[model samples]
Target: MLSRNQWLAVVLIGLLVVSQLPGPMVHSVSSRPAHLLSTLLTPLSQWMLSAGNRATRRPDLLQRREPGEDAVRQLRAAREEIRRLQRRIEEYERIRHRFGEQLEAFDYVHAAVTRWSGDPANPWLEINRGRRHGVAEGDVVVNYRDLVGRVVDVGPGTATVRLITHPQSRLEVRVQPDTADEPARHHLVMVDAVPRRGRFEAMVEVDADAPIEQGDIAFLHVGEHRAGRGWPEHAYGFDVGMVTRIEPDQERLPLLRKRIVIEPFRDLPRLSNVTVFVRREYERPDDN
Candidate 1:
């Protein structure tokens, strides 16, 4: 309703009033309240943000840790499995080696021992191989170490092995010189016939002047006939019993004789298994 001139005058008055206001007063009015409000709310705002992040991040961290733990457990299991497989492989190899050795003896028909005779009066062993396995009487039995005895009887599936330590068992052995000065002497030495006190002993007669001493090694020579067919001239080496005592006899036969006592090898008492060597042919003294 006002005239145009009156409207223009009113606008000019409003502008003058705005222009007269202080610059500091204007700035304070606009910025002070906003800054104060922000300062008052800062702690609460930060707390809320932290709580939200924890709520979300906790589950994520837990999930990641779970995977790590699972990986560690799986790795341990794999290592254990590998170790078990290696042990099994080694065991198989041992069994295979033993089988191969047995097969070599099988070409000639032989059996493995199961148990030894428990009787002290007649020490013997029961073998899985018998007459059916070509085991026969007088077939000399030997272990991996030394001569065990000979097969005296055979049954359908079993055979009895007379141990070398038996009362009636006897082995003819030759004495070999261990030193350069000593000559190889051939004599028939007896075993298993000496008294129990001497059961583990060996007696040898040497020249009175022979430099024979105690603790010398006595080698047992298996006659080619006693050893199995194709068996080597000397099947085994054993420490003849230790020389415990020595007796010098000057009045004995053509040569002065010295009696040397020896202890038998420890393999005697633990004889459970032995190999039977079948002698194929006899060799003359010159052939040896």
Candidate 2:
């Protein structure tokens, strides 16, 4: 424990020693502590920078996934729209064809079958077109393949057609013999009625000398007279039925009455729709 004057002298000597030190030595010593602190904090600073970069990019990744999901949904919707457009195109094509047929003086009317008679023997079809659509009794109904039937009854917007195979229906046909000399000279054969069974038979009358045979093609004539001497006049070819067999009846005199098995041109059982053709001309007895 020195006196007050001795302590003051020691403090002054310590200050003078520090003030006389070289500037380079002081700077080097001072920088050493800062360098040590910087090395220690380097890894923590780098870790914080890496974590912030990941946090910033997370929102962009989520946005990318959302766009990918939306693209998938849009692709599916586009496929369905293409299918709907294709169906509409098909319907338009069908209507266009129907219009062309009507404009060509074919006298055609398109009608969809709404109902069918339950009885297989006496078959009939109810059509969507009726008197309101120019559909009347005796209007011939046909399809792209062949004739179907004739309208029998009419309502405001609906009509019923008697099928070709119905018992009451009789199609006057010209039997073109397989060995005929000329197709124009072939006379008329009455397709009387449809048999209940046994190969779907029908009736026809022919002169005993007339060339008639099985497997002949029977063609239906709409407005033709059969008893003429020359070629058929005022006739329209509508149907083709195959003759399965022909059996002559001996009891019938000079004219041979034969039972002929016939099949229809169009399968009436599968008919869905048909076109009705209105006959524009009338036939006289002496037309042929």
Give all candidates' CA lDDT scores: 0.50, 0.57
Best by TM-score: 2
The collision pairs in model 1 are 142-275, 200-263, 200-264, 201-262, 202-262, 228-277, 228-278, 229-278, 241-263
- Clash pairs, candidate 2, are none
**Backbone clashes in each candidate structure, one number apiece?**
9, 0
**RMSD vs true structure, all candidates:** 44.4, 42.8
Candidate 1, run of 10 with poorest lDDT: 57-66
What TM-score against the true fold does each predicted structure earn? Answer: 0.43, 0.49
lDDT of 2: 0.57
lDDT of 2 at 268: 60
Tens digits of lDDT, candidate 1, 19-114? 788976665464445434434544454355445434542232113223354777767655644553464344335444544453344333344555
